[model samples]
Target: MQNRSPSRRTVLTCATAVAAGAAGVVGVTAGPAVAQRRDSRLKNILARMSIEAKIGQLFVPYFYGASATSPSRLDQERNLEELGVRTVAELIAKYHIGGVIYFSGWTNNIHDPHQIAELSNGVQRASLALPTPVPSLISIDQEHGVNVRIGSGATQLPGAMALGAGRSLSDARTAARISGTELAALGIHQNFAPVADVNVNPANPIINIRSFGADPRAVGRMVAAQVTGYQRSGVVACAKHFPGHGDTGEDSHTGLPVITHTREEWERIDAPPFKAAIAAGVDSIMTAHLQVPALDPSNEPATLSPAILRGVLRDELGFDGVIVTDALNMQGVRTKYGDDRVPVLALKAGADQLLFPPDIGVAYNGVLAAVRTGEITEGRLDESVLRVLRLKDKAGLLSGSPYASRREVDRVVGARGHRLTAARIAERTTTLLVNEGGALPLRGRQRRLLVVGASPAFPTDDTRTTVPELARAFDGLGFRTTRLATGREPDSAKIDEAVAAARGRDAVVVTTDNVDAASPQRTLVSRLLATGVPVVHLAVRNPYDIAHLGDVPASLASYCWTEVELHAAARVIAGRVEPCGRLPVPVQRADDPDKVLFRSGHGLSYGTV
Candidate 1:
């Protein structure tokens, strides 16, 4: 399953000019027109501020400040208590931190709509207590699907890849708007979303299912849509993982991934979506922790590479927006430097805001020391503070108390209309990959059906393959259904149990998630296909499952196993809705690279030849 090329090495590699650009680092200087438009109010405030407050503004640390004493699983995993600070008020007042990013552990154990609103208000009120009264840029990864951090009281719209499968620009816009609308209602100003990675390599461990698609133009179109959607609703949309994280097999969370494409290839494959995002006037761009030697030969990551961040993104792409780094706590950056040193390197590399530094006190002190020693110049720090302040001003945080009312949070978060919009996107994105001999549109209510469940087939999957809910959706359609659940791949005993149950059934429905990655799931499906009953295969994760299970009479992909998506899949199965979704990524035959089972944009229509 590992799809790395040995030719692509771990060390930074690039051409002469590209390497020279890294050394020269030419984009930090602002042009005359840009300088002319600088906010006079912000400049005056910056001139008056002390170094402590200025350094604080540059760090956006994560907060584990909910009153719940019992730590959630994420809290235990991240060791949130080790950071020392407890409440938002305490952290903001002490560090005078510029902003806060909320992770689920903050309130998962005791998350009420009113409590969340109160927490957000408290954070802002603490910021208001500061000398300059700079309201924090309250941010979350409300990216709407799998990447979402706040899910309980929010609209569960399909993720970026699902929208890509639907292939409707309007749907993409709607998803973003709904996410923005809901987050703004929660008093959150920034959303780290609309993953701009092109997902060129299917073997990519992280960006898959999050990215829009493999094609550059398609990703560009969706990225622009999401940005417009979020910003139009007053939520700052942060396009992420710049230049790109699409082609690497390594997950930057655990290890540093090196993207080995040449500068020409980088521009051709990875940079287009970011270009489109910048042109669309995105509010911020988050740097990836991975290394792109083509953009910088100094062996530094994109987060700490001036050539990639300033020369390419800021100067060449002309993006004057706030440049934020991906979480500083992630091992991608942490492995190279200690908590104290990372902030200085990130700032020196042209990053405006240091996000999620593991130790806020250390990171803050590090930046302050760097400023005093002239490692980070006063003017350079001002440039970033100016951009961050401008974004806050645009969000209307500078004018008054930036707090969400409990009444508004109750009314706007997960509103009925917003839920419908999410459902519609899910319905539209249910792709029908293969339907041989017209095996779908199962009729005859009296006929019995067999439903079998398999665990998610991801090469490294932790998510469950939702079965009972899917079976219930089918049962509601009046099929005399019998449900059976098995491990990702059944033991011989379970397979025997399934085969015996399939004998009298009129049709068989198998639910799978990422079967191509798990050999056991493939074996189970192939065995069931041997049965004489018509087999309907539903792939719940990656669409590549269909290319592997080609012999199944009918195959469908719902992208993810969310309730809305499973409901939409049921409608398609029962002939209540037509199959309209196309493939976002190609279904390449692993055995035959030249033979693609299904191309991108290929899908079947109901009752069509």
Candidate 2:
């Protein structure tokens, strides 16, 4: 397995490594005119790159561990199985991979800002040692809010829906700027963020809170603002899950989701945000795994559909920046085809980068074999190569030593100023959905309070603090608060215990998430309301949690469960701050989801407390 093609290992001796803008980010328009303006260094490097090397420039995959030399046990097994390499250094030298992605899970590569900086420098060192050296494009999913990749030491901003609820484009820009600055300080150059999906479906299991909102125009504006912020912060912003994945009920990681929209409906609903992204000169766009039948009746996932990628995204939308596929290893892209065919299909379908291929050896060799057999033209490969090279140049990755000053990282990431920005944005996202009988503004600050119900740590974050955030915030504000943790969906035993705890408290705060409308969590809310203590329910994940629990005395929707959001919700309950955020997405009935319970922009504000 250690033996490779002569093209890979034979280049170990001496190869001329040529060392290599953002109007450079726009579409490939001019032929000779644009070629004339291209940097001499870039042209030289391209001219000298072998067929093997140019194909290498199109592949970006993830490797395990925090170091390039020492492979984690999982990394050793996976890398050895795939490429017969034990370390990232070996992987780089052997495969000539163009980039590496950092992920929070699936063998976890991030620890803290300093550790990330170190790991990034190590990866760069190995990549630069290649016979034809080029800096690796280090990327992450640091979308902030719920999908934050780095924890503990990095500032975590509220998610995109929180911004939509807040309805502030400037706040959204600030969040992106802070995230970009922090990530760039740790040597990460690209953020797969600003989830441009306009989430119109409450049953959407994946993109609900990640999307900005249900309104296509508003979501487009928010995405544009984020793109501007991230690029100005010197980090490339990637507008993701193209052709929209917000209206689907299934998770693409597990199964393929088919979107049935007419061409006109798609133009009205899904095309606006991506249009806004391209107009803002977003550096990259990620193809989704879902199928939009209007774009292509062939039933190919957008990642493997020429009609969707080349016809729609490239030709119609005029997005000539790097078109990256959403992880090739996903079942959505691989269920019909094996790993070998997926990479070749994606490139032919118009993807510039094949992200996280299941097997690097198969993907690399498959494309190589295709090019040799005249199936994939060298001109087609160069089209992607130029786009990628321009992106690298725009990101300043072409410069040497993509490393951060370790001492400065501590000061730059999670700074006091950034956290304050996060808190302010979070405070603005607090929406008063139901304040029946004026049951909120909890009257007095000094009272016995029971903070209970299921939020389940923002629904997917592994780095959530164990201390109950609502209880802690209320405790700080002079309430004698008791916290009761119900699982994401409360069980009968937990509901009964919570109801019993509510008996003696002056007020009970119940926070529910995406549990079923008729579950024990609903029983918990009912039993707490039965106690006749002022029940202030907080829908801490989705606003629809308040759709069925409408009988409660009061309800609020923070649309998030982060510490900052919980703190802001606590302040609203205490009347320390007015509830100002509006619902970004309309609330449908939990029992009958088609019925509108609360329209978008439905939020109540207390005039004078």
lDDT of 1 by residue, 1-609 (tens): 111121211111111121212211111233465444436656766776688988888888766645323244565444446556555576777887778887674434225556666667667667766776666888888775456666566778888888999999999988888888778777788888879999878778889888888899999999999888888777888999998999999999899999999999998999999999988888899999998888899979889888988899889999988899999988898777888998898888889989988788888888999999999899898999998877776665554446677777778988999998888888899889888878887876426888886744221123434676677788787777888887666787888888888888998888876665455677678778888888889987788777676578888988777667777898888888898998888878967857788999988977773
Supply the global lDDT for candidate 2: 0.81
Tens digit per residue, CA lDDT, model 2, 1-609: 011122322233222222223331222233564445555557666776788888888888887777678757887887687667887778888888778888766655776667778788777777767667776788888876677778778887888998999999999989998888888888888888889998998889989989999999999999999998888777889998998998899999999999998999899999999999999889899989988888999989999999999999999998878999999889889978989889999999999988999889899999999999988999999889888877776665654335566766877898999999888888898999878777878887448999887746542355453237788899899889888888666777888888888887898888887757556777888888888788888877887777777577688988778777889889999989899999999988876777889999888988723
The lDDT for every candidate, in the order shown, is 0.77, 0.81
Which number leads on lDDT? 2
Runs of candidate 1 exceeding 4 Å displacement: 1-38, 65-80, 105-112, 455-465
Spell out the clash pairs found in candidate 1.
Answer: none
**Against the true structure, whose TM-score is highest?**
2
Q: TM-score of model 2 relative to the true fold?
A: 0.92
Candidate 1, residue 412: how far the Cα is off, in Å: 1.1
